[model samples]
Target: MKYLLLLLPVFLFAKFASNESCKSCHPIIYEEFQKARHSHASLFKDPIHKAAWLISPDYKKKKYTCAKCHTPTDEKLLASFDYKQTIMPDINSTAQKDGVACAYCHRIKSIENNETQNINIISKKEHVYFGNLKDTIKNPFHKTANNKRFQNGNVCIGCHSHYRNKYGTNICSTNEHNELDSANCVSCHMPKVAGTPSNMKKRKQHAYHGFAGIHNDITMLSRYISVEILRGIDRFFIAINNLSPHALTLHPMRVMQLQVSVIRDKNVTNFKSKNFVRILGVDNNMTTPWKAKEIVKNTSIKGNEKRVSTYMYKLKKGDIVNIRIGYYLLSKKVAKSLGLQNNKKVNRFILLKQKVFIIKPNSFAPLQQ
Candidate 1:
């Protein structure tokens, strides 16, 4: 009878609980979250691993660690607190993507209740959000009953500061092994930097969701006019090479690659990945990536010429074409290194070029080259 009672409510939340509950009013935050590093697409897609099989009978205990560090919120989703595996299919599936989500934070009872207790106490806030998980926008009907916990740093400390019990235990003094840190994770990730908002009195905006790491700068830029495309009578071209050496430094551990394509009758995509260039290096290498379009046509650099590559295309009329430039960065260990994980500025690059056309529309049409 006792076991039956516990099973009853577990079934209820499973039926009704969702992350969309909080996304209702947080549309922009929700959309940016989909592309965040915590997303499964980035964590699970990684190449490094400790032991894939033979360690534990459960795959969740092994392969799912990536999700924990990348998207973990509650213990059920994580395998172990020390390594990345502390994750479950259900919780990891949602909580990880939310990244200090509304439900995860709103559920906090005290600053001390962050991630220490296994207990999930749900006290709603008046204007607060809930865990809907379905829609990206927050629902007014789902306002959390207001609580004092929301007024302070306790909200951010809960998940950011945790204990690594699977390995051993330690006094709160130690911050290693992913447990509680000497300074809370927010001390660095969301540093208390001052920013002057418009005409308002200089107010602190907590640290903001930017987190200020990896390709974060680039990610924020994508929300606006990051890419500009112009299709000509012959070849389709894009002028989105905004990475400038002078802009900011690029993260070392990050591998930035750009892909360019052109097709006949939108055939650009049908064909193979036309041409690509990968600019993977430290901040010092940032300035080297920029080169004028004229440099590519040069036969050879006799003396001290920094040679760069290009993706050139020649298209004709009535030909469908597609051009895509995608950018992705590494987090976790990568960000953890170079002190970037803590938050530092990296270098960036800027490029300029013209899409060349081999033939005129009236003169002749080229198949593809």
Candidate 2:
């Protein structure tokens, strides 16, 4: 039996193709993927990964732990470093530069379990590719196998779900899988388009390769949250509902802030701010990239959670109030410390819903101004 197994065709041992090879058959997907965050997963370009590598006290001695997700294809570079130094892979290599390349994802045979960081990918060097569709067709490039996990969203659980640090503490908690019933990652991230997956197949709805996420657009945020403002005699109430199945600001470094500002006579008066921050690190330092000790201040709304905060201010007639919301990938202080250019402004923040309530001696009503 062992001798017979060795007699298999040489294509069984064929090396996996590069992203370029995948482009020949999947040009549309390749183009969209280039715009995705996954394509820019290189350590040199990713600010978070660079900052972590620069600040980690154990980076020089231990293996960089980030490689398991960022650049899994650079196995040769990973082995060159000490087993402890597993996080940082060789960023100098071509395969590493591709980030999560096309071959890396399609070649995955199976995921052993759903543990976020402990995803066990069964890979083979052969030309066999796996997909959600079951209709096997003869293709010139490679063979295809059906994987139901791809359809159910379990395939993405390993990377998108909660993950623990070396200290056995939850560092990255993204429970998107548990939030929606029967909804898969592809539904939102890779929206379906009326087209075939490959040129060799008939026209059918296929998932887009954009892989939309936090970096995509504000429209995505609006889909998961709703905001309303209620006015009282001396205080204003801001109500936020987390319509998402997953926690708001799932990543440790990500933050969402709700701010209330008062304007009088076309000038700003009082400003109050509340932060929904995910705290991580050894000493509850929000700047720490990974190995979170605990959640220091998690004011963020959980799955299907609703929160209302009241701000009190002495309001006179003709007073205009502006309520705004901002979302950030990292605090300005942390971003400055890391010398990142993208952190100066609240780029991701958008005005969800704002209202101006005029206070009269006897009554208060919302005004257009």
For this target, which candidate reaches the highest TM-score against the unseen true structure?
Answer: 2
Candidate 2 runs further than 4 Å off: 1-15, 79-92, 113-116, 133-137, 176-183, 194-196, 200-205, 260-270, 282-292, 313-324, 341-369
The window of 10 residues in a row where model 2 has the poorest summed lDDT is 7-16
lDDT of 2 by residue, 1-369 (tens): 777777553234224466777877677777878877777776776767777677775465655656557765566544555544443455566566777767777766665545445474756646777787656578788877766667676566556666766565666666533444344766666777776777776657777777766565445446556666566777766677777667777776666788777787888865657888767656656546455566666777787787888877666667766666657776666566566647544235644444455555544453322
Off by over 4 Å in 1: 1-11, 15-17, 39-100, 111-139, 144-150, 162-207, 218-369
Let me know the TM-score candidate 1 reaches against the reference structure: 0.35
- Global Cα lDDT for candidate 1: 0.36
The CA lDDT of each predicted structure is 0.36, 0.65
Cα lDDT tens digits for candidate 1, 234-257: 344444433321111122223333
- Superposed on all Cα atoms, the candidates' RMSDs to the truth, in angstroms, are 15.8, 5.9
Task: Please name the candidate that would achieve the greatest lDDT relative to the true structure.
Answer: 2
- How close to the true structure is residue 196 of candidate 1, measured as C-alpha lDDT? 26
- Tell me each candidate's TM-score: 0.35, 0.77
Worst 10 residues of 1 by lDDT: 287-296
